[model samples]
Target: MTTGIGQEREKNMEYDLGAEVAEWMLSQTGAPDGARSTTTLMGLQWDVFPGVWHPNPGTRLFTSWLPIADGCRLLEVGCAAGVTCVVAARGGCTRVVGVDIYPAATDNTRRNAARHGVAGRVEALTSDLFAELDEDDVFDVICSNPPLVKAPESRRIDTATEQMVYDPGYELHRRFFREVGPHLADDGRIYMLTSETLADPAELRKLAAEAGFTGRVHASEAIGIPAPVMGSTPAVVAAADEHGVVRVDFTMLEFQRG
Candidate 1:
């Protein structure tokens, strides 16, 4: 079922909408290419890497709804800028592990952890999902604000930046559910961030069910973002905001092994 945005995002389904939004956001901030920079989010300063996904509204919403507890072990997959990892560490998690496919992203997490004085509680690893994690490494809390936009392989740009936006057939989402059970403590909880503007919640539920997990919407909110409009190129830029903005429905899905 859809909320907030309704059918607005479906208007530009043929275009690479995820990349368009990212480009518009980057252009608005004038972030230099291939350079490291710092920005503050969730009231904490974060060191952002060139190709890493910067924390956005969805990221913030997920963190706000995250179920972290003191002394619990936490794991954040696709921890681009390590925002969630640092947040968990500061929240009193005994150990917070942040994993990403990009080495630069892992380094960026380390930098942010150090900058925030949580280095002692955080470990940054370069990994694709749980590949590098030990089979016995389990956590009380496992969370990921993964790439939600659904696009075909042919349409994907395949950069680290784009990887943060497009899931390309929901392969990553499928893998996440299929692989997560073994790494979660019996009482562990899993949280995933998704949006109606970018994905089909029903399909996600099917994937989760296939992997033996029961899921529910833990939290949801409506957020406005730049609308996509027909242009010379397929990209819907931030400039389109002058025309109007579209409301995107963001949701945090809670899952437990069935």
Candidate 2:
């Protein structure tokens, strides 16, 4: 559902300009191309130059933690456009399941998997988190770049591309940590990406600990905004400061389950 906002995010860029710019960059052609030229992760070549949101830096950063053992079952939460799924499959994962709330995103992901010649190894489904997933199912690895924006009550939906800006707050993140454990194999691990805007290393650690899982911060990067002038708003700045240090766009966070 459209959360009282206009049909297009551009109309309200003044409210969340950084998110707007991020959306715009994803629409561009350069981002994805850049990803392709950069590095090969999990045997998949990414297109990051044209942008388009595939191979999101956060997702790529988290992929490093994925064990490359062949025949491993991997699940990608919020798989947008399926690029990460392709990477996992190419990396020799026996099975890869991509779950998202947006049907179009899942469709795109499916198509992309076919294009990469890994459709047989990758499956994309439209579901809200683990709702549609079988509780007994287990995975060797899990990865996600969840919605971590802190916006007003006006923005909240299940679209994969839409900016959450808020809604899936810190509590939801904690819930994710708690719920993921049961779906993991004995030696399974999780790789999650978040920003300082939602929560910090300490917060995620606390959540994992409470869930009876050992966790560690694998990597972190300062949230860098390419066009701060276009997307920086007072609300965004203030919301970012609430968690940790506020920067331009987002502070990339990687959480590993041990």
Q: TM-score of every model?
A: 0.83, 0.66
Over 93-151, each residue of candidate 1 has an lDDT whose tens digit, in order, gives 99899999988789989998999899999999999999999989999989988877766
lDDT score of model 2? Answer: 0.62
Query: Can you give the lDDT of residue 41 in candidate 2?
Result: 46
Worst lDDT 10-window in candidate 1: 230-239
Indicate which candidate wins on lDDT. 1
**What's the lDDT of the predicted structure labeled candidate 1?**
0.78
Each candidate's number of clashing pairs is: 0, 27
Off by over 4 Å in 1: 1-33, 153-156, 226-243
Clashing pairs in 1: none
User: In model 2, what is the error at residue 174, expressed in angstroms?
Assistant: 3.1
Q: Model 1 RMSD to the real structure?
A: 4.6
